[model samples]
Target: MDCQGQTIEVTEGQSCRDVLSQAASGKTLKKSVACTCGNRLVDLSAPVPRDCSRLEPVLADSEQGLEVLRHSAAHIMAEAVKTLFPRAKVTIGPAIDNGFYYDFDFERSFTPHDLEAIEKQMAESIAADKPFQRKIMSRDEARKFFSQQNETYKLELLDELDEDEVSLYTHNGFTDLCRGPHVPSTGFIQAFKLTSVAGAYWRGDENRPMLQRIYGTAFADRKALKSYLAHLEEAKKRDHRRLGPQLDLFSFSDEVGPGMPIFHPNGALVRTILEDFETKEHLRRGYQLVRGPQLLRRDLWEKSGHYQNYGHNMYFSEIDEQVYGLKPMNCVAHMLIYKSALRSYRDLPIRYFELGTVHRHEKSGVLHGLLRVRQFTQDDAHIICRPEQLQDEITGIITFVQDVMNIFGFAFELELSTRPEKSIGSDQDWDRATTALHQALDSMGLPYAINAGDGAFYGPKIDVKLKDALDRTWQCATIQCDFTLPHRFDLSYIGSDGEKHRPVMVHRTILGAIERFMGVLIEHYAGALPTWLSPVQAILVTVTEAQNDFARQCASELHQAGIRVQTDLRNEKLGFKVREAQLAKIPYILVIGDREVQDRGVNVRFRNKEQAGTKSLSEAIEMINEDCQEPFKRGGMRYSFSN
Candidate 1:
């Protein structure tokens, strides 16, 4: 017998089932192994392995298995929907990140009440424990069968398929055109939740009939599902849209169009502080900051493969009868800078960094406040290096990612994405790039998943995902090694051998996007930014108009000391001002009442809690400066005080 093109010896006249059993006992060490007998996927219990070569059992926790479970859950959901709403017509059901969604071409939009009812039906379907049965049929047979059942959406799907024979999955009297290896029964879906409802187009085409898409998430167990739900609740509470406004940080206007965020003065204060810190950090790391235009000629993108591979996601305009595209990436311009001058092997590992704003067309349905936006800034960098120096460059990037994320108190996991199916350049080049990434990860002693066929078309990549306080994972950084881009752009450097050779290019980002990171930070800190990063670190107030001068002086001193200070010299009473500041979550409240003003001191009040005693002018500055320098999680600013 031959499996995956390898020969295996089996006893003559042995039953196929027996042969498969033996094969399962001696399965290969590969991660995702799927066995096909005569090009047909089957379970190990099937009796076709005797005549089959290349038969092996797939790993249970492989990506393939997870997809199978998600897809199966979608089918179970559809079956439940049909059981509940007999008139609903199922269109499409597919697996997405950690979940599955099924769309139906129904007459009315599904309401929250409908979702609750559908969820109840789904629970009952799981309890019924119906089997997921697969059937094979010719294309004509499938089209005729679905047509007779008034499943126009299924008929449309069948028409689009190019295969001679189609596979159909059935569960509890409901059938769908599918190529699947589902869980044996509905009982396997122990945990699931109906998330939301939205309108979507058939086949994602605007011209097609609109469908009501029901989003949902499922997990292997009830505990896992509950954990996910809890994370979702936390995410909503941390949502920057709600917190940003309540905290008086940012706003969006209909006049400015959707997806473009406007930072208020307070928001700018926070962003300015972050940018200043990052600028200093980048300079210290030997990076030269550069700026580029917001839009460039489309021809440049063509050379960089952005036009070919990602043009559809870019915003384009016609100027002077020529196409100009808003920058979707910062790399091409950096490449042009490197090529502007002649270089030798001596200038081998040149690194250029940019906090560049880029524009990409994200679907409106997918856009959420700051997380998914059409325009955002990236903390991007490009490293041009020699092949021999690739590993060290990658190591440096890993360290950079670690340092930056550690500042936010996040622990991250890494994954290496290998070559994708729709890739450019030669196989040898891809192999080398992939090997270098694997070697880097191995040398760092970091455990990571090898995500096969998930890399960019140009090369392999290492993705960093951070776990939040709620145990939710968010991808925050990526390091990509590209050999094809150099070849495509004819980027070259003089070798030590005095000949031109393509330099290996590494694209790395510490923070994937600033807006998304800010959103994450809002949730991570629960809208209470640290003293060093807060929009308004302190609020100063006077007991009456008599002490307004003292309050103004206090605010000015803190501002000069690089602390964001706001003075509440409003005509309101001191208690009212203190209450307002506390409600705004300000870290510090300095009150200059008549007693403290006469004594040349200020009363200190902490937000969300009772007050500390008064301090002199010099004393207050010294304390605030110390607390701002090294903030902590103790609610109020951390200070170094002597007894």
Candidate 2:
């Protein structure tokens, strides 16, 4: 067998661990919890088949290997929970992206004290060095065993499976039903932590019994675990919900309803800046702006396939006893606009953009502050083009995404999501859509991964996930290739042959939801936004009321220069005013003291508390102007002040 590119002779009855321990070069058998044998993942103790031609050890540092470790950690956690509370019953535990969570049918919710005790017990189990032994049993035998153990959740899961054989793993006098590939022993879980606990429903069905969920994470070593914990700490401090209100940008009221953000003056100004910049950028790229009604007839939505596929997430009203659905998407209105015109292939690609606000009946449980809201605005657009123009349209949208994300100083990744099982389209249509997206991505040489069966109901799409300062990714942009909507709406264009040919639609969004984007921005910049994006770019402070007139004059001059300036002419001390501006995250704090008034200049301090020295009034205006325009250059766009 070839193990890690080296030839190793394996006896017929020897296990993978047995052979690898004697021949593997870099990895120890203790760290190799599993191995991939001819494309199948198996435990290290599995007997190497005679026909096996290739094998690769799964190491602790690799993603797959970490998943194995976390999976075993979940089992250890479950064992610890059972030991602490004998009445608790075990359910499913799986490794997620950052950690693992196991849901349990406990009589009461697990508290922080319970988590602490569970962690203590888990530490004991890991230190005991108990070997994790795997066993196989017949379905009937497993059922009888779990039934006698009173593990009802496992029995329910077992009853749902059709396989005759079942796998089980055990350690520290505890066993659970699971597929094999655990670490050789409990001591392998060296760097682990129990993060938090929450309530989750079994199988995500709200009608079912609720269960307590224990969340935890494990790493290959202590250093990695420490770094990850630091990142988590920083993320908590930079959470958008906390920063939004603290920065005086936005707020949410229980009386105003959830998921609807009440943007203060500052938040509104920032949002306007983003929208205005996007408008100019879109118009420069040959996009026409458009708008549609907030609610449309239910029959129109039905014809668009949204009524069937997305009805659960939509809100409906009755006017004159006719049902009208609140628009969850802007594509339907854009489709009607396309069908209203009849043209030759010359108008092949017509791009229409809208900063459209939409409403979705999001579940209360999933309603996060701004990230997952019921009402939000989208930088939405729809492009209608002939079949021949499909690839170019897709490429153009991808470029649009790249340029915009670049302007915001964000690094992004892409994924091509294919047609889902619940989607609306024929196999031929889905294939053609996927091919167009694939060809465009390949032509541009843009690296992207495929997410199978995660597309919109009407089409396949390119999902752009942008990384924030914390290295966490947010879903901000998406480019979709849609053929269903045009066909359903009977949208067509005249071809050179004088026959009506169906046009394809491309649905897209740059900054997916304005609320979510702003939330991300607040956290990305740690509430210290750029001068161009800051509502109050600078605040003028006076010394002992002597320079109040001078401060007012300076503020007015800056305001006339189109720099957002505010005046703090209060009887407060200069230090107090500066500290308030700094806490509010103003970009520039201008100090107008007696000496600064006589010199006809002001001292500037940046939000970072760095002193920028004194400059004349005109020079200060010019400096702030440059600061505002410099960010636009990141997207290669040149800006000039108003004439």
Candidate 3:
């Protein structure tokens, strides 16, 4: 065996902890959460085989160690809750991204006060520093034990297990069923916080009993936990749900529907700008604009495999005794467009772009403000090309994503998602599609993580997730290669040999959905979008009623110059108007006081409160226009300007 370049002989049945302790000599080994034996992550207490080639330490501060710490923290939290509530039944608890949550069945709801009490109890348990011991028993023994203790949830879980044996981790006389790689002791949980509580149906089934879920996060130490808490505070302040109403950008109403959002004048302005930008950008890239109906015949969806693989998430209706489905995707319509006429190889790479709105039957419980909604418009596009053109098309889409994200000042990562369990497609087609995406990323020398079993039903895809200001990732772009759709729809083109050949389809979206992208943009920029994207770029303010005419003239000039300018000429204090403009996050505040009226110039106060010396009206307009130019055009892409 090798331990950090040092060779050592391991006897039969020697535990990883034993070998690690000997290798470290006088150094402390307790910080190691687990050791990787070959490719398998094994607990420190697990027996090491004689043939194990190498041992690598999983430090508490490492990724795997954090998962172990959070998992153990969840168990400790459950122990505290059981001690305090006594009758609360514990179910499944797992470590998730950024945190952990444990579901419990209790007689009543858990209040914020209960969370505090449970936290205090957890602290006491951590102070005791009890060692966590793992024991294996037959499924029957575990069932009998839980049954005698009246843990019906545990018995139910056990009954569903197919394995003959199971593992239980116990600490401080509290035991839970888990396949765990927990911390060595309870005290190893250096920092943790119980975040909140919510109601969740058992296993996410609405028909099942409702359970109380406690959410929490854990880190290696206090500093990491404090940093994470600070990020959470910033995220809360930037939450689009709060900022949307505060800025009067958008709103959700009971009258309209739960997941449907109504955009006000200000919000509509932003959406219109985004859509216009999408149109111009796609046109510049040689994509033709297209439109499709909101609903399509159910037979078409079944032929496209959406009915079989995506019906559960689709909304269907019976019209004129025929079943129809609200379009959840724009690909089917685009395929029909390709079939509308006989195509030749000369038009192989035909790109169709649309601002297509779609609807999905999202569970009410899962619907979020704009992030997860029922109806949203996608900046959807489809490219039909020959087999040889797949790589170049995918690369071009990746470049388009980079260019668009750059315009929005976003840093993003790419991920390749493979086939899902409930998807439809031939194995050969799936493999080919996956391989094409892999080659595209490789050709560009871009690194991407693979997301197993999470692709679109029709094909594998490359998902682009943008990192916002707070470093939170949001899914916004995708590039999918589909070989099945064209075959299913019999979309064909004439080759040089005058033979009919199936065209390869590429489905992609630069900005995934207008609503979700807006939500992300709101939070990413903290409601202070760049001048070009801001709903109101500048506000014209007068010191008093005397300068109202001058402000009006200035507003008209700015407006004629294609600027979204508003006038604030109320009989109010200058400071009051300035404060209001600042709160609205207007990029520029043009103060037209008596001096400005006399000089025919404007005093500019930036949103960040930086002052710009008075400038002539023409100068101010030119500067604002330059700042308002879209980033891509500013980067030297020629575009015709219009209001």
Candidate 4:
């Protein structure tokens, strides 16, 4: 067998660990949790396959290698849990992006104290360095063994297995059903921590029993773990749920309902500015503004396939013996508008834009502040073009996304989503749609990952995830290529040959939702919005009653200059007023006093602690105008929303 680019003679039954121990490589066997034999991952202690021809070490620091360690950590954690609370039944535990989690069925929720005890138990197991032994058992035998322990979840899992044999991993007297290549032993779990606990539904089915989920993370070394913990602390400080109300942006009341937000005047102003900017940008890109009703006839939804595929998440009401579904999307009405007119090849590609509000019956368990809300507005648009024009239209949308995200200084990743098991249209149409989206991304030199079976019910799509200040990703933009909707709606256009040809539809959004983008924007900047985007851009503070008149006049001049400025003439010290403005994150705090009254100038202080020397009113306005235009330096049209 070839090991680490060197050929070595191997015994027929030699284990992977035996080969690793003798391989001449810089990566020590101690730093590896698993090894790859050809294309398959295998545990170090597992015997090599009879036909294996090549082998390589999987380092503990790589992304996939980290996942292996995290999964091992999860198994060790489950062992500790079972040891402490024998009555606690364990279910599936797998490693996620950030860490790992294991669900337990118990009578009560796990507390912080319980987590500490569990950690101590896990430490003991880790110190013992027990070997992780694997075995393959027949389906019947596995079911009977789990039945004896009263592990009903395992039994149910076994029942769904189509394979005649299942693999089990056992360590330190505890066992779990898994298809895994775990670390050589418990000793490999070097640096780990159980972070927090929450209630989760079994199998994510709300009707099923609720279980306690313990979340944890692991790293190759203690230093890495410490750094990650510190990052988590910083994330907690920037959480939007805490910063929103404190900044007087938005709030939610349990009495009103869950998943519904009440925007304060400040938040409303911010939203208006954002939406207005979107409107101007869309218009500049050749998109016509449009509107759609909140409720559409049920038959219309059925015709568009939304009622059939997404009925479970939609809310329906009866009006005078007719059923109407609250719009979960805006494409249906946009398509109706297209069908209302006769089209020619000259009018092949028509883009309709709308800031449409939609409603969906999201589960209570998954409802987050603004990120995952039931009622929100989407910056939605639909493009109808001939088949030959599909690629250019998709490319145009990609450019539009790039322009908008660049304005906000956000970097993004792209993904291509394919058809799902329960999707509309024929296989041929789905393939054509997927190919159109893939080719468009390829032509633009944009790289994207494939997200199989995660597309819309009617078509395939390209999803864009934005990276924020914390290096975390959020789903913000999408461009879906849809061939089924137009065919279903019988949308057609006159060709040069005087024949009726079908038009294709593309549904997309620049910012997925206003509320969600705002949430991400708030957390991205930590509530210190840019000068142009801030609801209150500046505040004028008066030193004494003598300068009140001057301050008011200055405020009027600034306001007349199209600045969002206000005056603070309350009976308070100038320092106190400035401090309050800073706390509010106002971009500029202009101070006026007797000297400013005589010289006709104002002192400028920025929220970032930068003090600009006294400047005349005209100069300050120019400074603010320049700040507003900075976002457009990325090659977008100049339109200041602050006005």
Candidate 5:
């Protein structure tokens, strides 16, 4: 075998090194790796069979290499935990984005002290540099061994394994049931930190025993870990659940039901601003905004195939012995609308937009403040186009998504999701839709990942995930190519050749949902919404009773100038008023006192800023007007909205 310029030959059953040594004049150097067997990376010194591909080692710095390292770190963490807590039952441990987590079913929840102790144990384990050794065993033997060892979880897991043989990993005499390609030694995990403790059901089923999940992050070096920890702290400070109530934006009530969010006046105002902006934008893009019922008969869902595919997530009701369901999606209703009229090929790209509200029965345990709510409004659209125009229509939707996301100064990544196992579409239909999505993404030259089998049951989809100020990504937009819904609803259009053909449907959303977007914004800006979306653009504060009229006049003038403004005529110190406005995240505060009234100017205080400045009332209005007009737009903008 020859690689690049190197020539190598292997004798039957000889290791890679023997061949390299014979190929090179005693110059071939040995390499190091995590594993090498069956796609498992290992040390370079490890023997490679004559049949081995014996490919060059991928360095730890490579993207794929880091994944291998992270997986090793997970094993180390599990080993440390088992060492610390002997009674704990280990389940599955896997690597995730930026880190890894392990689930353990223990008699008691792991407290903060337990986590700290676990961390210490992990550090010690890493320092010891114990080798991660793997051993294979037959299913019956493995089951018997685990049962004898009092590892009920392992026995339960082994029972589900149909394979004749399975693998086990051991570190420091603490062995776990795992199929591993872990790093050679614990010393390779130089930078790692345990992050959070959360409760999860065993195998993700609520009916199963609850397990304590411990999350941690690992990087190749200490610097990376430090930087990640800093980002985590910043993210905590900007958590929407914390900032939302502090800014008086929104709240969730137990009485209203879990996952149901109640927007305060200010929060509602922000949502209204988004709705107005998108509604106008949709009109400009030739999309007709439409309305649909929040709840419909179950029969409609049955025809759309949603009742069969996603009935579990749907909230069904029995009214007069007839079943009804709250709509979990808007595509079915939009398809019905398209079918209402006989469409011509000229109306191929019939785009319909709606701020459609939807409901899903998300598990109570996963009910987040607003991000994963059971009830939320989607900025949904459906485009019915000719088969020949599928690619163009999809590309148009991608462009529209980019333009809308730009409004909020969001940078996003894209993903293409293919068909799932339980999907409804035919093979030909799925292939065409998936191809169209891929072509659209490729045409746009956007970097994307393929989420295999992650699309909607009805179709393939392109999901756009926005990266916020903290670089955290949220799925904020989706463009789904659906053939099932159109067919189910019997949608058709007259083609150019004067023949009727089924119209291709593309379901899309610029902002996935109003409530979720607002939540994202709260976290992105740390609850300080830009002036354009602020409930009040500016607040006019009077220094004293003597300046009350002047403050009101300033506010009225600003309001007449098309700025959202209000006056705090209460007798209070200018500093107190400014502080109150800052607390509300108001963009600007105009302080008018006897001095300002006599001068016919106003003192200005920017939110979260200590310094104040004085500007002519007209000058302040101009400053605010520029800011409010581009609330969604970033750069060179300022506005104050609070009193």
Candidate 6:
């Protein structure tokens, strides 16, 4: 077959390395980590097949090669663990997005010291440069081999395999059951570090025995690994769980039940500001604000196919012998509202928006502060439009998401999710809905990845993942197209032909969940929110008791100008008050002193400790008001104290 416009033929016994070496005509192969024969990735040592059409090298720094390197590092880690604890049973070890993890069942939990010792052993093994050997054996032989060693987890895994033969990889004395195309030797692991250890139930089942999962990361070289570790350090500093309480944002209480956060006064103020912004924006976009009940009849959920597709993640109760479920989504209520009235062709596109609170039964292990909670508020909206107007409606939602994300200073990527296995819609319906979403994305020249079989049960969706300051992606916004919901709810509108036609439904959220979005926002800005979003935009501090009255007057004027201002008239030092205001991340500190009272102006200090000099009361108010404008209307201008 042709490769790089060259015709090359190879015999069966020749390895990929030999073939590539011949094809290269004496060029070095040090940069090549692996080779792909057709669609399958294989090690350089693997024999070339006669049927191979084209062969290409996988570079060490490429995405696929990084995965291979990480997987190999995981095996090396397992070997090191086995060396330290012979009785430890290794389960599955897979490469994840930024790293890799290996689960092991030991008599006791592994400690920080154990991790260090394991790392030492891994380094030693890598220095030895032991080759990884792969072997295939009959299922019975593999079972007997693992059973003899009393590796019960491996034995159990072997029992579940339907294949008559299985593959095993061995490095020096350690062996593991895996289907792999790992690096040639342990020495290939040039840079790696074990990050942490956590408890995970076997196969994620709580009833099963708990296993100690060790997480680690590997990169092509030391520089990349060092950069990643630095980023991780920054991420820890920006952790919302710690910053939330430090900044008096939100809290969780044992008595209040897990996964339910109690937003303190400051937190509530931020929430209210965000909700108010959402309301004004929605109204400006021609959306009507609406509210729905917290719970609905179980039959309604069943009819919507949620009971069958998402019941495991739902909470249910029996009321008056009729079962009911807490709303895990806002679609049902919006659909009910749409069905409550008939619509004419002129009203084909009716948008309803809600800051709706929803509850879902999340496992205790997965509940992370506000990021993953049982009860949270969602900026939910549903738009019902004619089939002919589906594409335009979807396009409008995409534009809306871009505008909102820009206001938050977030960069986002989009993904199109197709129908899942348990989805209820007809193939034709799914196809049409998926086409409309694609058309919208394509029309805007937006590039999106496809997440196959991961859509909501009733519809296809576009997931918008926002990137924060730490460069981590959070799934915040979504636009879903549902043909089945209207059909299930029997929702329709009169067409120009005077005939009733089923109106298509589009489910969307600009900020998907208020709790989660706030958490991301807190971490994104490191608790120093923009002036417009800050709970207290400014604080008034009087230099002396003599200036207290003037400080209060200044605060009142600022408040009247729509700034969230508060005055500190306590008998505290001016420096102390400034420090406190800065600690609270207040955007501006207005200092009123004898000189300022005489001049009828105030000295302004920003949260970043930059002084804005003295400004007359009216000038200060005007500058503050300009900074307080919502970011969307301000053309995506970010917060700057200098401004």
Among these predictions, the greatest lDDT belongs to 4
Error of 3 at 39 (Å): 3.3
User: Model 6 RMSD to the real structure?
Assistant: 3.0
What does candidate 2's lDDT look like per residue over 230-266, in tens digits? 9988988888899889888899999999888999988
TM-scores of the models, in the given order? 0.80, 0.94, 0.95, 0.95, 0.90, 0.94
lDDT of each: 0.80, 0.89, 0.90, 0.92, 0.81, 0.89
Rank the candidate models, highest lDDT first. 4, 3, 2, 6, 5, 1
As for model 5, its CA RMSD to the true structure in angstroms is 3.7
lDDT at 590, model 2: 91
Q: What global local distance difference test value does model 3 have?
A: 0.90
Q: Give the per-residue Cα lDDT of candidate 6 at 277.
A: 78
Model 6, global lDDT: 0.89
The worst-scoring run of ten residues by lDDT in candidate 4 lies at 634-643
For model 6, the superposed segments whose C-alpha errors exceed 4 Å read: 1-12, 23-28, 542-546, 568-577, 634-643
Tens-digit lDDT track for model 4 on 59-88?
888787899999999999999999989999
Q: Runs in model 2 with CA error above 4 Å? A: 4-13, 49-51, 638-643
What is the model-wide C-alpha lDDT for candidate 5?
0.81
Q: Model 4: runs farther than 4 Å from truth?
A: 544-546, 572-576
Q: lDDT tens digits, residues 136-174, model 3?
A: 999999998898878898998998999999999999999
Off by over 4 Å in 5: 1-40, 43-46, 346-348, 439-449, 495-499, 566-576, 608-612, 630-643
> Which is superior by lDDT, 4 or 5?
4
